[model samples]
Target: MVIPETFFAERTSLLKASEIRELLKWVAEGGIISFGGGMPSPATFPRQQIIEAITEGISEHGDKLLQYGTTQGLNELRSELKNFMEWRGINVSNVDDIVVLSGSQQGLDMFGKVFIDEGDVVLMELPAYLAAINAFKLYDPEFVGLKMDDDGIIMDSLESVLKELKSKHKKVKFLYTVPTCQNPTGVTLSVERRKRLLELASEYDFLIIEDDPYSLILYEPIDVAPLKSMDGEGRVTYLSTFSKILSPGLRLGWVLADARLIKKFVLAKQGMDLCTSPLLQYIAYVALKRKVIQENLSKIRGLYKTKRDKMLEALETYFPEGCKWTTPIGGLFIFAWVPERVNTKELIQDCIKKYGIAYVPGQSFFVDESGTNTMRLNFSYPAMDEIEEGIKRLGQAIKERL
Candidate 1:
């Protein structure tokens, strides 16, 4: 008797698997130069210091680190993160309020677990971080896509959405934003827009989840404060990570929210992995103490800026005329737009099949129906030479289709 077995929660059915990661698996098989993933260049990693820290980490706290540690995370490490953010202008006086997660991605997942419920309305930027869409989808939250421009999420559209939601007798639970150096599109939120958003959040009485991992890696200094920093009543749940600047393998990130909300997040973390890796936490602590973090960050900013510049130049030179892309002030991605008739999903397939070049279609990043002609190109992993060659190959690929 063949009984069909269905083993899954209803939430799992709504979520789509990562398209870029799935594509990368096959792209890897081709041995073609790839730019589909947002991986940092290994050359910029502080391997020497990390090695020294790890060696010293185990030597100083072998038994304590290897074993399970506090659910809230290593207190000393959280304090360091607090101090770091304070320097950056996020005003957090108490370190106990922060909960260290495996990474910022995990922090997002936990936030969803705490806040999102079936049928609750959530506002997200159109063409946002695919992982955030997936994470929120797991809770079956009703998503509203806010339009985006060079200054970041469109204020008029945001107002319209809020008004519409209000008229319907529904209020949004939260508005998710990437603010500085957004995913897919590397547009930084302007100071004016930031204030406007905070005002909107205050008026509507909804939270703003500010995901800002790439803000610190900017090529030049930008005087924009995090949404959390401007938040008066603890309305912003801010999250950032060490994945881009230090190392992804560390899997270290922290979330800053009101102490009340953080309690629930801590409980969620308790069930997830008990705690983040104590060994890595120790290493981070030592690195922070030794001031290796600042040095490594400087190196990363310089190296990635060079890569980004090369890619931008290549795009200018090689891509067809009339094609448009944002000149990112910071971050690993550059979003390009072709004609509306061009289906980027199909283009991705064709490029991979014909030219052996890969990119993520921008459609997947948007919750509302938009961005069909858009694609996201990562400029972080490839070297200067690879950026030139890859962009040339991609340009050649696009021209062939044209």
Candidate 2:
């Protein structure tokens, strides 16, 4: 089954497996205490409701649900999603502006396919989502890592980078951001900073892709709105998912952009999968109609808040000196920085095989490959007791390495 190296495409070299995904397979085998994947807790899924929705949707629309659908997605789901976006203050004047994705992850890959030419500039946070980095790597863009503070991306650093890029006469294709409750770092952009980012995007004449999957899962009340909602120039493409709120199994997510861009997304998505499954789209349609997602948000917030607190408390009680982690008000990960002497990617193997613990090392998350001393831990997937024990084992492993 092995192919010769000569048979492979040049882009095949960009296809690296996700560290979280490979680690989750081990976690599924049930020996390790995993702080790896950014997975929603099973407790958050509306099991009974999902079962009912699936059954009912099939019963009522068996002819359509079982068949292939349009590439732009179901009229029902897009119509429902339009209202959903409006509720969140995202402007959508037409249902044609929405393009349902198989998942937001697919949107990332499509963005690269749709936008990037080789050597094009794409700005990303210093410690970004590993999957997005991987997805975009396929198109061979020069990923410039923007400096981020606790309150999301630094404006001064971004403006300076933009100015320099302009001086070089290089165009930035788009600045991909998870602005609210960013991945790995779990930082939220301030409202002021959001305005500034939009301002800079306008000034520099670059597009913005706002990958927003975690803004609604707040533990504390934050006033920050999604950048797309604030975008005045139609430059931001707003992408989000039902994975956090409803069910990841549905594989339902969506993108909201200008009608012109939606046309391109539809064309791009047509070749990708034809369409997101009509059956799953029907389930999402039903869930939204019944207000299942809205009702479940409060419960999810409370469950994850307790879990986040437990992990934070455990780190304080167990992790050694010269280690610190983020205190996220929302989102699944707590990014940690250990001693510079420790390369977290190297430390993780001993932690897994020897200490029965796993985490996503931060090096792959950094486009610049500078976060060798960092790691990302997820609290939402594991139980509180597992969080405590896993953090202890992880701390011991880091200490042994140190």
Winning model by TM-score: 2
Q: Highest lDDT among the candidates is held by which one?
A: 2
Q: Following a full C-alpha superposition, what root-mean-square deviation does model 1 have from the true structure?
A: 1.5
TM-scores, one per candidate: 0.97, 0.99
- CA RMSD of each candidate after superposition: 1.5, 0.9
Which 10-residue window in model 1 sums to the lowest lDDT? 3-12
lDDT of 2 at 322: 97
Candidate 1: pairs in clash: none
Q: What clash pairs does model 2 have?
A: none
Cα lDDT, model 2, residue 69: 96
CA displacement after TM-score superposition, residue 1 of candidate 1 (Å): 12
- Stretches of model 2 off by over 4 angstroms after superposition: none
Give the number of colliding residue pairs in candidate 1. 0
Give a tens-digit lDDT track for model 1, residues 98-172.
888898999989978999988999998988899999888899889999989999998999999899999999979
Off by over 4 Å in 1: 1-5
- What TM-score quantifies how close candidate 2 is to the native fold? 0.99
Clash counts for the predictions, in order: 0, 0
